[model samples]
Target chain A: MKPSDHDNEHLLHHFSDMDQQRESAKLGMWIFLITELLLFGGLFGFYTFYRAWNPDIFHNAHAALDVRAGTANTIVLILSSVTIALAVRSLQLDRRRRAGKFLLATVALAAVFMVIKYFEYSHKIHLGQLPGKYYHYTGIEGTNPHIFFSVYFTLTGLHGLHVLAGMGFIAWLAIRTFRNHFSAAYFTPVEMAGLYWHLVDMIWIYLFPLLYLVG
Target chain B: MAHATAHKKPHVLPLKVYLRVGAALLVLTLVTVAVSFVHLGPYNLVVAMLIASLKATLVALFFMHLLYDSKLYFLVFASALGTIALFIVLTLFDTLRRGDIYEEVSRPITPDAVIYSDTARFDTAHGQALPEEGLMPLDTAGIVSPPLDTGEIGEQVDTSDIGRIRTGPGEGGR
Candidate 1:
């Protein structure tokens, strides 16, 4: 099929037009998000198993977490999620400059989340609260407190990596958006990236309370 | 009618809706933190998880555009979550029900379960003060004491001399 101003110029021949292309792209992203959910699910499953087996240890070890840092990062990610949502809205409305700015804000907020995560991780490391057999912090003691750090580091480290990846995606999307490549007729990339960014924030929404506020 | 398929735009959430959802998420996070400090015993975990799930729902609905999206997308995500929940529940079912799986009555005893009276040797003589058969040193208030001369339990250990954590399997090699 030939491209029309009504559809996206980059529409492929296999797809009939841009709407078809956008629907297919979104469905594809949702499929990919399913797999991503499963990937995180494996770690979360392990966490549930261990947490159930040793509730006391999980709670005790989690008490050492910095609630302030966790809370701050939660706020940053929530704000970033809002910004990314706004960026997608702007692209849908043909406001390329405003969309680019929102994307940049999302990227900056994601970086801040990563920076705060780094500090939280470093403090844990300095206190010798390492994972598995390497855990050496002595204040909290329960049956295998090391296992708590094991789950903690695994979950949060994976989450931090996702944040970094989302930032990269948004950064690239922002650049393309500023190049005027995206308009109301064609902003699929921005939407897909925004979905991914939202998943990052979604994962942290659970992680904040799971790891930090276990009580 | 056929030409109508060419211009189906994606749903764009209003700016106000996005802000409302974001504000709700932040408020829920605050509520999660505030509730964690309250000692509701077992209910604390449940409440924390409930709040976390609420926050996750908000992100998925508003931030991910699932609320306005096709039902197929929401179905896929919900199915994925259901599968994960099933896996966790099943695995925990096996792990939680093994009360007697680790117990070994026929084997040689491992030094009387490492009692408080003696870490190396199991001496019933030191436990003579206790009414029970175990070596638990209980005060009149019925509190177990650590073998160390340090203060009561929950005190931070002397971590100044603590070296790097050991890094091996069953090495206990600090």
Candidate 2:
């Protein structure tokens, strides 16, 4: 057997073997991802119920959101998800330099998404179109308009926090790749990071239409 | 071959497949924007959500590597999503089933429409002043006499009455 394979065979006390350890770690990550889904799911449920209750108000209020900007961000996030997936693939092939480059691309795309979001949020704040009671703008005369912005801000704000966290993870992973910390033998970190980054993109996929395109 | 199998790497889709998925996602986004302008009435929302769902599925299956992962991971994700969907549906059922949520909100603000559950204060729809809904809310000038001392005084003013119409500048509920 190869020296590395011999080293891997000495399993930790908690794990019966290398296969068990790897499978358990993966299953743990999946469980955590679902829990994260549930957390966001609650807020999403809130938006769904309110949207159904006041469909017209949602329609009128969402007009203030810039579709162009939202569309751009959606594309940016999709690109980032793709790059991160590529990064994981590169690491699995033991291409450290390629993996690092893809990680950089993913981080760059996430930065672009946040920058666009900053402009969108600043515009809303400037107009005093704040969530709940702070909504002061009168551009549209509709019932319970504030509720729409309330849901909008709440959903986007939470999703944005996830994006920020994902960016931090990608940056760390990239730096680690530069140090040759991952190889085909053990590259679970890159794969896990890729999973998380895709989730961020998946959320924005839903948000883009709900907030900007449709009522 | 046996050595390579023991040291196996996780499955990775080709670069071409990833690029193709990215292209499809971008195209679908554009389609969403285009569909919004067509004015499909209620269907507009349905179509948009469907497209968004398609994009999300692609990202999850390809980019997230769920397609190549174990069935156990699939089960976890599916159950979470199913539960979330149930929560939304049940909450919406409760909310949509309620009575007068919209009527209560819109009755006061509609300038042209008259209000009055039991009787019309005036034929506001005609030349008469708009009714205050089922209850005629009167201003001080309109009030024939001061309300008599009542146990309910200094308590929550019934907004349905005109005496408290436009309660205060900060009172956004009205």
Q: For all the predictions, what are the DockQ values?
A: 0.32, 0.34
lDDT, residue A212, model 1 = 90
Best by DockQ: 2
Best by lDDT: 1
Docking class of 1: acceptable
lDDT score at residue A181, model 2, on the 0-100 scale: 87
Candidate 2 C-alpha error for residue B115, in Å: 27
What local lDDT does model 2 show for residue A2? 37
DockQ of 2: 0.34
What digit string (tens of lDDT, one per residue) describes model 2 on residues B1-174? Answer: 122366445375678999999999999989999999898998998999999899988887888777877778889999999999998888777666543331223222222223212244443222233324433345433332222334223122232322122232233222
